[model samples]
Target: MAVTLADYEKVVGPEVMDEIRTLAGYVRHKSLQNINSTPVGGGVAEILTRMIPLLRELGVDATWDVIKGNEAFYAVTKAFHNALHGHPETITPKMLEVFRENTAMNLEEMKLEGDVLFIHDPQPAGLIDKKPTIGRQWIWRCHIDVSNPDPAVWEFLRPWVERYDAAVFSMPDFAREMPIPQFRIAPSIDPLSDKNRDLEPEVVRGVLERFGIDPERPVLTQISRFDRLKDPLGVIESYRMVRRHCDCQLVLAGGGADDDPEGAEVLREVEEAAAKDPDIHVLLLPPFSDLEINALVRGSTIVFQKSIREGFGLTVSEGLWKGKPVIGGAVGGIRLQIINGVTGFLIHSPEGAANRAVELLSNPELCRKLGENGQRYVRENFLITRHVKDYLLLMLALDHPGERVVRLAGI
Candidate 1:
C-alpha cells in the first residue's frame, strides 16, 4: 500500500502536513528531477524513494532517475567516495578517465530536462556539463563529509562543483569555500517506512529466531552496509569487549548498493572477524529487507553505528527513531545526530563503544531515558517532513537569490 500524506499526519501532526502542502503550492509550477548513482542501498536513494512520492502527492512535479555505470566506473567512484571521506586512495589519470567516460555515457543517454536539475554526490556530478544546453537550475547535493578530502580529488571535482547554481551539504562543516550559494540540510528518515515502522512483537521475535539470535539475550546491532568506513570490524571488536563484562549477542546486518564495488571484500573481512562466534550474527541481507532490519533494531537492547567516517549515517536516526539507544562514532554527521550524553553517547574507539554498550545494557533506566530523548530529537528535527520543507524552502530561495526574506505571493 502506498503511504499517503494523511498517514504521516498521525505521526507529525496536521499542522506540519499543512505547511508542506503550502510550500509545495509555491513551487507547483516547477518540475524537479533527482539524479543519483543508485536507486537502492544508501541514504541518498532511500531518501529519494520516499521523498519523491511525497513531493508529487503535495502537487509538485518530481521525478527521480539513476545514472548508469558499469563495475569499473563504480570502482573509481568508490575510490572517490573513500577519498572524499578523507581516506587515502591513489587517483590516477586512468581512474579519472573511467569516471569521465561513464559520466559521458550517462549524459548521452539521459534527457536533462527539468526546472530543477538535482544531481546527487560525485557519481552523477559530471552530468552538470549539460547545463549549458539544458539551462536549468542545477543543484549539487554532496552527501559526504568533505571537510578534509584528498586534495587531488577535491581539485578535480572543484571546477564541476563551482558551476552549480547552489550546493547542498549535510553539514555546515562539510561546506567548502565555493562561490555559489551553499545550504546545510541534514538527511532524514521516513518514520512510516518498513525499516522504521512499528512492527508487531511476533514479527520481531520471529526475525530474531530466524537469524539465530536469542530473544532473551540482549542484542547489540549495527545496521549499515559492509563498507570499511562503517567499521563493521570495529563493531565486532566492540561486541567482543562487551562480552567480557556483559552476556549479550551482536548483529551486523546490511546489504550492498549498486554503486558500491567494495562491499564484497568488506563483507569477507567482517565474516572472518566474526569467525565462528555463535553469538555474532553477520547477515548480508538482500535489498528490501527493511522489515528484518526494523525487527533487528527493535529486538536489540542497544544499536551501534560505529562508523569511522560517514556522510550522515541515517541508520543512526532509524535506530533512534525506533527508540533504541544509539552509540555512534564521533565523526561526520554522526556528531550531529548523537548529542554526546544527551540523546546518545559519541565514542571514539571500539573500547569506548563497548564501555558505553555495557553501561546501557546494565542500567535499563538510562537506556530508556536516552532512547526517549533520541526519539523526541528525531521526531522534532530529523523526520522526512522537515526534509521536504527544507527542499521546498531551498527551491523558493533559488527564485530570490541574495534576498534576506523570500516573499511568496498571496501570503
Candidate 2:
C-alpha cells in the first residue's frame, strides 16, 4: 500500500500529479537531502516519510537522514522546543554542551553533499554553522511558531538561523524579522498514506472495541503525541463538560517520540485526570500504528487537535481528509486550517471547545456539513501533492530568482 506518484493521481487527478512531475523536472538535476532528529514520531518525521519518495519519483536525487542524539541531547532540544513555543526556559551551559556534542557527532557521520540541504527544527540548527564548510545552499525550515519566542533562546538560535540561505516557516506570523529571505510553506497530509486512507467500518469498530471504547456511543477523539503543548488534560476537561450535556465518550490516543522525554510525564498526568471517567479511553499506541490511528479517527463523531500552540496540526487535516469535522485551537497554523464554523470551530478555552462539541453533537446536520466543507477545503489546499509542488517551487525560486515568465505544465 505504499503510495507512488501515480497513486496520487487517483486522489487528485492525473492532471495534478502530472503538473507535479512537470515541476519536478525543473529541479531534477539538483540534490536534496533532508536532516532532522528522529526517523519516526512527531510531524517532521511523518511529513518527510511521505515527501521523500514522491520527490524521488519526480527524478530528483532526494534522500533523508536522521541525526544522532542521546537522551540528554533531546532533553535540551525539548526545552528548546517549549521555549520557542513561547514558554521561556533558562538554557544552561550543560544543555549547550549537550547540544554541541550531539551536533558534532552528527556532523562527523552525516554526508553534507546535497545541492539543497534542508535542516529541520532546533534539534539540528547547529548544523548551519557547518554550511560554510560544505559551501552548499542551506535552508532552515522552522515548523514551530516563534512569533513571541523566549527572548534568550531566540537570540541564541538567531545567529545560526541567519546563516542559512533562506528560512521557511509554516505561517507568515510565525516568521521573525530576520535578514534572510523568508517563505511560508504549510505542512500537509498524504491522502493515500496509511494514516489517511479509507478504512472499513468493521475495522474502525474493532479498533474501538480493542481500546475498550463503546462503538455505539458518539466518540470525540484526539490523536497526538502525549506532549504538554497538545494539552491532553485540557482535552479531558473539555470532554467532561461536553459529557455533562451529551453522553459522548472521549478517546486520547498517541505514542511517544525519541526526541520528546516529557511524553511519559504528560501521559501520566492525563491518565490521572481521566482515571475517574470510565468513558474516557486512553491508548498509548506503539510506533507505526498508523492504520490503528486512522481507524480511531475515522470512527469518531468529531475530532479535536486542541494544541495550546501548534505549527500546523496535520491531525486537523488528517481528520478532515477522513471527512470528520475537527475542533482545533486557534493558534499558529490551526487558525489557517479552521474557517470559523465553516470547515470547523475555533476554540480558546475548555468552555469554548465544550460549547462547539456540544453544538456538533446536538446537530448531526451541522457535523456532516462541516465535514463536507473541510474535506473539500483540504482537497483544494492541503494535500501532499500541493506540498510537494510548493517545495519544488521553493527550490526553483531559490535557484532562479526574480524571473517574470516562469515555466511548468501550465501550473
Residue-wise lDDT of candidate 1 within 165-189, one digit each (tens)? 9999989989999899999998899
Candidate 1 to native Cα RMSD, angstroms = 2.5
lDDT of each: 0.91, 0.88
Compared with the true structure, model 2 gives a TM-score of: 0.90
- Which ranges in model 1 have alpha carbons more than 4 Å from their true place? 70-72, 256-276, 409-411
- Segments in model 2 whose C-alpha atoms lie over 4 Å from true places: 256-269, 402-411
Residue 364, candidate 2: alpha-carbon lDDT: 95
Candidate 2: tens digits of C-alpha lDDT, residues 97-194 = 88878888888888887899999998888888787787888889998878888887888788889998889998888889988888889888888878
